[model samples]
Target: MLHQPAAPVGKDPAQQYKMRLGVWMVIAYSLFYGGFVAINLLKPLLMEKTVLAGLNLATVYGFALIIVALLQALVYDAMCRAQEHKLSDQKIAGEVR
Candidate 1:
């Protein structure tokens, strides 16, 4: 069963915080990705150099970017979940008192 939040949805401070966090995360990703793309375009030869036996710098960097994005998403999700849990606990405590 979905427990009703004790606070109003629109005005929840935690929700607002989460929204800002998510927006900033997106902006950060954009900057990081834009830099990567810019580097690739500016120095094609640098990106093409083989870093490992079968992987070039471009391929490695591309994979790293994907991993970074995935990690950021996981972190954001965890942070939101933590905030939600905190809110839930506060509501439960209010009911008990």
Candidate 2:
């Protein structure tokens, strides 16, 4: 009789991490793109009043997008750190077993 190899027990942490990161990336990109498009679409109405001289709608929108990107980076970093901590704890527990 041929002996069969045992099936893998649990999910691979690295793969799980990659999968999660991919999902978050997709979500972030979608939100960013959607917001950019929406801003462009509403630019005429939004910048009707001239709060500052020499400031065009495109310039203001560009600055806002930069700010949004920075915030997204911070959020993503925090999420990655949390995921790392959780994975480390899981690894320690597995090792103890």
Q: Model 2, poorest ten-residue lDDT window?
A: 1-10
TM-scores for every candidate against the unseen true structure: 0.74, 0.54
Q: How many backbone overlaps does candidate 2 show? A: 0
Model 2 TM-score, 2 decimals: 0.54
The parts of candidate 2 lying over 4 Å away from their true place are 1-15, 38-57
lDDT of each: 0.87, 0.71
> What does candidate 2's lDDT look like per residue over 1-97, in tens digits?
2454486456556556756776887688678667768866876566444445677655666676788767777777777778867888999999999
lDDT of 1 by residue, 1-97 (tens): 3776786455454788799999999999999899788987898788888898789988988998999999999999999989988987898899999
